[model samples]
Target: MRSYTADYVIVGAGTAGCVLANRLTEDPNIKVILVEAGERDRHPFIHVPAGFVRLLDHPTVTWRYHTQADAETSGRAILFPRGRGLGGSSAINGLLYVRPFAEDIDSWEQSGANGWNFGNCLPFYRRSETWTEGSSPQRGTHGPIQVSRVENPPEICGAVVQAAQKAGLQFVDDPNSDTRGPSIWYYQQTRDGRRRSSAARGYLRPAMGRSNLTVVTGLQVSRLEMNGTHVSGINGTTSADIPVQIRATREVILSAGVIGTPRLLEMSGIGDKDVLDNAGIKTRIALPGVGNNLQDHYVVRLGYRVRGAGTANERSHGLALAREMMRYVVSGTGVLTYSAAIVGGFAQTRLATRPDVQFVIAPGSFVAGRIGVLESEPGVSCGVWQMRPQSRGHVHLTSSEITAAPTIAPSYLSTELDRNTMVEGLKIGRRIFAQPEVARYIVDETVPGRQAETDEALLQYVRDNGSTVYHAVGTCRMGDDAMSVVDSEMRVRGTTGLRIVDGSVMPSITSTNTNATVLMLAERAADMIRLPMAEHAASTYSKESV
Candidate 1:
């Protein structure tokens, strides 16, 4: 066995791990070991803005985890693609940077995640952000991550924006300002000019040269070494299956994302007793909440054929690619800079007081059958999903082998409320597209088409078509409750020298994209870990980046 010791051992050099490594190593006195299960973020497409679609179901760069076949989704298994390398999902995500509502964070405080309210966490969000549009009382100015507007948006996106407003959806200056309020606006990018500003680029890249930071990529972490209830170290394998042990003198931080975090805990006998028993693993901690409370946004899409204008579908292939290549090389602007979605926002539905539906509009259309292939015709796509789903699910270990994938059951649309939300959300899409100003460009609704007008037909369409927005959260929930896996500071309940600092710690799903909120979670976690035990109990403002 190859053994090494560090002040802190971080598993998974993902968004949260990058933040933790950057912050923890700031004190040079502390030595850190950052491990990842996949290769480095060196793929050409990983850095390009519009090239992310080429990364789906890719051999590397993505951990394409799929759910079990479900009746709710027409007996088809849904693909739950997650980033795999240095930046993790941030490297492969839509690059659309957004934060949840104050209501979402306030609910965290209310739900027993004390001291995690918007007020306490907003400073971290601001500290990590360096907005291109400058600072506001509500927005951050000088930070690591760059948030900017899409420099060159297609005319089709503008028409859709107007159509949403014309259909009675209000436009808010900042949707995070008031999350419940319905709004439509230009989509923001987590890019700085042409490059995707991932967590690795923002946090890890600068810290890579630090003497205290040691990054070990492509290492498959197996399980934690327990000194009683405390995490003493971690054991894993290198590319050649060479055993490696990393002993942590201080703590072991798990930032292996939602599925990986809980799976690691369970493999180390830290999850539910029954689950461990079934998996043939002896129980050590028996935290039932380790893999419970799985939540994600289930989206329903609507595709429309364009008449007067051409979307990316027309430019995604053929000689058009050469033009975009030259355009991007010349000025770092064009269709090549397009994110997964261009324009979208929150909208109201008949079933809820707040804006329950979220829209992500893209200039090009992609059929479900053709995961990475754009349509041959001129088309645009709009994806709408319920902001908050009442349905709950779980991820559990099914085999004793650490490399074996655990069972993922999202239980999508399990409740009538969730099912209705999808149905009504798609109906709202029809209304927006039907607007006179927006409809003028549309030849017709090509997704569900004119035949699927009734509520039942829409519901059937949702069952057959709705898929994940790739925002999985809430397992290993953070709260003070008995069932909560982690406390307010993200310390694993009943364990010392061990903690979870990823999307898995969310008490409930946020009503927005989870990437920004996950960054905030890590920002707060890093601060808590850096402070003394006394100050850790309080909100210590460590705005080093600010």
Candidate 2:
């Protein structure tokens, strides 16, 4: 075995892992090894803001896991694409920068995750990004990640904003500031100039210069190396199938995301006894919550055929695309710099007090039931989803092998409230489109057309058409409960020197895109692990002083 050692071994050089590696290594005395199963973030498309569409399904950069076929989804397994490279999903994700509401994290504290309320987390969120408008109480200015709002959005986006305002939603200058009640706003992108500011670019690259940090890519970790209840390190193999062993003298942190983390735990014999036995592994921790509590934002898209306005579909092909390429090269602007959505908002349905529904508008439309492939005709697409879904699912290893795909069951639209909320959210989308400002575009609802009018019809349409928004979370949930996988400090229960600092540790799925929260969570986790050591050192007196 090719052996290596570090004070901290971090599995998965993803959103959280990158932040942890950067923060921990700042001490210079701390050594961190961040291992990624996928390649480095060298793919050309991974840098461009709009290149996400290409990387979403790219074989090299994404792990195209599919949710198990369920009755709620009309018995069809839905594609769940996760980034596989250094930045993980951050590199392949839509660059929209959204944060969860205060109430979202407060609920985490209420759910036995002590000291995890929004107030305690805001500073870490601020520490993760540099907003375009500079530092403010509500924004960050000196962070590694550079965030900017969409400037001079296409006319269709303006129309959508007007339409949303007409539909009883107030337009906000910064939706990320106060995302409560009904509101519409332009989206901010995780971009530095024309390039996407993935976690690798924001945190890892800057920290790579540190001699204490080591990044090993293309090393697929199979299982943890444990000495009784304490995690020692990890065992894995390189891309060439060369056996490798990494020893962690201090700790082993898992940031392999929602699906990967739990699966890793199970593979390492740290999950439920029944699951471990069935998977042909001996139980180490007997944590039943390792792969349970899976939650994701399920969305249904409404496509429209437009006439008066030019959409990305027109500019994505022929001479127009050539012009866009030139525009991107020269002025660093054009359709090539567009994010997954130009306009997005949050609004309340009858289901909840805060915004129960979220909306995202793109100045282009994709084919029905499939994304990435734009329609030949000019069109617009709006995706709406219930922000807080009650539906939960689980992820389990299909085989004992590390390379085998897990069985993920999202159980989308599995509840009455979820179904009703989705129907209502879809109605809100139609209402926004029906406004004169937007209706003047003379676009007809193409997907679940006007023919699907009743609630039942809309509900049926959602069952057949709804898909993941790529925000899977809450699998290895953190709580002080019996079924909780990790504790408030993100340490695995019944285990020593092991922690999970990713979205999987969330008590529940956030009310918005999870990347921002994941980044903040890592920042906080690093402090939790380091601050105590600093305090202990500071309190110790020298022999002369004593």
Candidate 3:
């Protein structure tokens, strides 16, 4: 029966939600409430750089949703793991930081996001990062997120780099400098020393003590309270399952991610009329775009057993694990300090003008049947993914029950473009691994082995083994089109005092890991939200300062 109020009510304390909370609450006059479905990100593993392996599918810190059995996936249901709690997916994501190219943002501008060109987006990207490599004209200096350079580079990684060069790929200073290239580079990690610099840690945690911001965890929002199409407040249940209402005096922003955002919209009766009707709920808005245009990067791993190399597989057991633990405890640099993939490159398949495939090479392999568990012996892996997949699927409510996870289908390899590109990508990986510098380390090909050599076999391998790179987007696509759920500025269509600032707002997915892009988006959104408030506050400033 109790209700709460704030100038802004952010629905999820994930990447976007945390940024909004930190920026909006800068003004003491603005009261902000951040509601999260997971607990505070205090788990020890959440902070350790290499702790991502343990965090993936972690019941405590993740929303372990499973996709409806995708036919393209050999009828196997893929695990759709999303982060819960303060940092959201950023907390559990591999600490890889990649700035998307200006061309990528310009494409968004071309596609309908009017003011979101590379020129417009570059500032936000720079504003959100404090690159430890020092201030470059292209990189940021005094930003919240700390991007540490890869140090104590592993020899295997160097060999892989050499192999990429031997294959005629160029090594670039910045991956985001250009989109299509066969360039090898060290992963930019969002970390400082040994600790992970998740959005929660970088943005939200520092702002938690602010009087204007209130962050509540374990509050699973149920629905949006609408009055004549305007979102008046949100109805949710606390950790104790106590019903509560939180009203926003200014706006209600949904940063619940690509999956959670659209599902929450439909649950609140803000989606297609037919979808609402099927769910037995009256439609508040007939916006057909909600929960549609689902997209993701599907990757297939080519595992190779290693003989004379130190791989992460070995680091997970025996003296190797103990030594790394001690190394991290002392200096925070070791085998456990690297990103998800050690060295990745963007290469063009002969089928394309630009780089369509991303080669993610990791100095480790996973055991068969165990998704995240590392192999017992030394091994390496190269996961090839189509950066820009043409296949489109969707997320929709299955039942009226809030506890039920939405029906998610990424439609991986459903199109000719996706299928062909994946095959070419797999070939690219094989080529890179076959280079003499890198080939010497390989003992044998284990995954999809030498047997799956033909193009048809490769396609089948992708269908049976390809899974999400965890970069899901476009469900609440931002555009001027009728199919778009939100506009260029992230304002939800046909809704008042409501907006979505997350990866879901991306009109198209970026070529690399999405955290950097998401942060940039949220940073710009924060400025937009506070610009008017800042102007209003400016009037109250002393005349001398002005």
Candidate 4:
């Protein structure tokens, strides 16, 4: 096995990994190494905003995982696509730039995530953002990641926004600024014109020129090399069919995301004893919480056919298609430059204190269940998702080998509370479409149709057809509880020189898109690691002089 060493060895080059790599390597004295299981983010589809449908399932860029046959959905297996490239899912996601409410961060602090309240985290969020619109005191001007509003909002999107207002919802200029009640706003995307502003493009690519940082692609980390209780290095296979060991002198950070991080821990004998035993691996820590607490937002799409001369369906096909493609190629401004969902609204399910559901308004049809080509349609589509679900699940190791995929049990709709919330979400969605201005454009409800009236019927429909919004988190949660896998500082419990810095560390799901929060967490984690050392040295000298 080829051996290597660095001050920090970060696993997974996704969103958090890229941010951590950039921040940690800023100090020239600290050498950082990042390992990614997938290849470089070089695919053309990954850059285009509308090309996410293709990149979502591309085996080269995504780890296309499927859940075990779910009991809630008539034993149907669900597809879970996660990014495997330099920018991670940020490169292939829907590109909706949203930060959850200040209350959501306060809830994290209440859940034992100390020093993670809104006030403490706001600065980090601002520090990592470089908004294209303009600089704000609340937003960063020199950050790597780019955040911008859509240049052109489709007519259907505007109608939906107006419909939301007609349905008693407020219109907000920036949803990210105030995330309270139901409010319609233009989507903030990670795009520079038609090109995606993923972490690879934002941070990693710029940091690649640094000699102190080394990035290895196609390196699937199998296990953590441990010496007693201390993590020494990572043992994995290189792209060239060679085994390798990379030692970390200071720390071994796992930025492998929710699924990959937990699986790696299980393979290293740090998971449930029964699971480890079944996989024929001797238990090292017997931590049952290592893979527990899986949470994700489930969405149900509502499609409608519209009557119009100029629409996304009209432009996606025939001669108009060629013209639109030419327009995009020439000026990078067209329907192809925006994400599938151009406008969205965040609202509370009930008369709650915080918003717990989001409505995504797309001018085009999203035919493919998980992520596929949009079907031909002149109508608009709206997807309603319940955020902050009360239900939780687990990820278990199917085998001890790295090549083997894990068994994912999301347990969607497992709780009665979650079911009730989803029913409310559906009701709220229908109300928005029923408004006079928005109602004129709708032809029919293609999804639930007119049959979904009663709450029980909608709940049944949700159990039968609900799908994840691709926001899975809280598996390797950070807290001080006995079941916590990592502490508030992201240090792995019952282990030394080990930490988890990804969405997996989130104790609960955010009220909005997870990418922005994950980036902020990594930014804060980098500072946490650096600030202590600086303070310690200064204190040591003062004490010695005294």
What lDDT score is found at residue 29 in candidate 4?
70
> Please, what are the lDDT tens digits per residue for candidate 2 over residues 1-546?
788887789999889999999999898777778999999999988998888888777888988888899988899989899889899999999998999989899999999999999999999999999998978887999888899988779998998999899999999888778646689998999999989999999999999988788899999999999999999999999999999888887789999999889999999998888877877888878899889999999989999999979899999988998999999999989998899898998888877777899988899999883568888889999999889999999998857977789899988988999999999999889889999999999558898888999999999999998889999999999999999999999999999989999999999899888899999999999999997666433221111100
Question: lDDT tens digits, residues 1-546, model 1?
Answer: 788877788999889999999998898677788999998899989899888888867878988789988898899888888899999999988898878878888998899998888889899888888887778776788877899888768888888888889988876655544444778977788998889999999999999999778899878999999988999999999888889888888789999999999999999999999999999999999798989999999987899888888788888788998898899999998888989788878888999998888999988888751236788888888898899999999999989997788999999999999999988898888889988877999887788888998999989988888888889999999998788999988889999999899999999899989999989899989888888733333222211110
For residue 186, model 1's alpha carbon misses the true position, in angstroms, by: 0.8
Ranking by lDDT: 2, 1, 3, 4
The lDDT of each candidate is 0.87, 0.89, 0.85, 0.83
By TM-score: ranked, best first = 2, 3, 1, 4
Give the number of the best model, judged by lDDT.
2
Model 3 agreement with the true structure over 406-459: per-residue lDDT tens digits: 889888888998899999888888888899998999889998799988999988
TM-score of each candidate structure, all chains considered together? 0.96, 0.97, 0.96, 0.95
lDDT value, residue 238 of candidate 1: 88
TM-score, candidate number 4: 0.95
Assess candidate 2 and give its lDDT.
0.89
Q: What 10-residue stretch in candidate 2 is worst by lDDT?
A: 537-546
What is the lDDT, from 0 to 100, of the residue 93 in candidate 2?
Answer: 91
* Pairs that collide, model 1: none
